[model samples]
Target: MNEKERAPIEDTHFGAVTVRQDGQDRIAVDGEAIPRVTLERDPAAETDPHIAIGTRDPAHLTMRVDGVEVGLLPAKGRFSRHSYRVDVEYDGAAYRFVPDSIPSSRLTRDGRHLGDFSSDGDETVLAEWREDGEIRPADAAIGYTLASAFGTGAQPMWMMIVDGVSNAIP
Candidate 1:
């Protein structure tokens, strides 16, 4: 019998929630050292799970996967310029903890990345991050307030476009 060779896809697990490769739209569930892939919103079987980060006077934030709202900040106005973290576990792996605000930016109609996050343990490996490009005025609808703080000259607001195709880790 011949063996089949399969490529490794990036995945992470934090407690109970698991984020598939590249933090794409879908996540997996781990059970007894086994992994079960979940179906995320599709853009041609190509899903892009996203995280968004921003600051507000009241500190209201929400996280969604592929347009499907997954988590919400019930306690609005709880934080002020502070970073919130949530680590999810899936597929027997632990993905870094991230805020809903981070992915929201990617899921937006015109979302972009602001920066990347280093792995919790490895410091050298890039766990996850946002795009490093400038988001257009149209894309800055909700991020405008935060963007203003970064300046509008050349950098404006640090952003990134998640390339799910890469299948990298958080």
Candidate 2:
């Protein structure tokens, strides 16, 4: 959708953090309405949509914090279209995001617990972080955008088959 036509899809608070996702698939945090991450739909994307964090390239899916860009390179699970797990590495840290259920996923960094990304089966989605200080709000926001926007969890085999058949017919 165009920028003017974009509407808010989610606006909710989890503890002190506020997360909002707009109709354009841009997600913002806290009181500032500026999008920190955006899910950019690209027809050329190999499997899933591309992500833009800050002013970085959407194709590379880099994360920018305080004007410094951190490269988020996919480490595993990139080939299988049905795979639910995605592993990435950046700044010497290994991050893993795997589905806990259809509407939620768990994020970990270097084998340490980080937080969760969940939806209420509606427009509202949340990213709640652990209290261990290992994860920041920006990190949680990135994780949430990745899991929610990328369709990170596996779809049922029957549903996949149905989708494939339907797409082929059309």
Candidate 3:
């Protein structure tokens, strides 16, 4: 039988919750051992690729949270090349994940500051958030996924220097 080979699975923890991605298509939360999240890709889709939660089916690009279907959409960045934003609305609040640099992104809702997610070495960390206790597990999960997929981990000082020198030369 011909079966697609799966990539090595990796688990990343964000406080109490654990997110596991198979490095290919599957991503799960809290040791569910089932594919509760996936990256669905379609050349014809406006978003092209979407983060699917609660199922592996490519047709379902949205996840139901509290009876509300939250869909992830990719919006092109206004000023940067090769950078984009992921937008989602959950519980009546519209959230946007904007990549600020190679290793971090800021989270905002309706132009209000909310939180920031960044890569620390090999791990993604929720560096800060609103003090009023507005962030949720779903928010963390989605944010982590976005960071893992789009943002690069923190680079060593040597690597950064090398990159800087290379860019300068070119």
Per-candidate total of colliding backbone pairs: 38, 0, 0
**Model 3: per-residue Cα lDDT over 58-129, one tens digit each:** 364443443344666655433352245667776677877776556667777766766777753122344566
Highest lDDT scorer: 2
lDDT comparing candidate 2 with the true structure? 0.50
User: In what order do the candidates fall by TM-score, top score first?
Assistant: 3, 2, 1
What is the descending lDDT order?
2, 3, 1
lDDT of each: 0.26, 0.50, 0.50
Count of backbone collisions within predicted model 3: 0
In candidate 2, position 19 carries an lDDT of 39
lDDT of 2 by residue, 27-125 (tens): 444324322544433333343223222212346454443344554544344323335565655456777777665456778888887877765322245
Clashing pairs in 3: none
The Cα error of candidate 2 at residue 91, in Å, is 4.2
Which stretches of candidate 2 lie above 4 Å from their native place?
1-35, 38-67, 73-82, 120-123, 131-133, 155-170
* Candidate 1 residue-wise lDDT, 43-119, digit = tens: 33421122212222122332332333333221122232123333222223222222334322111221234333332
2 or 3: which has the higher TM-score?
Answer: 3
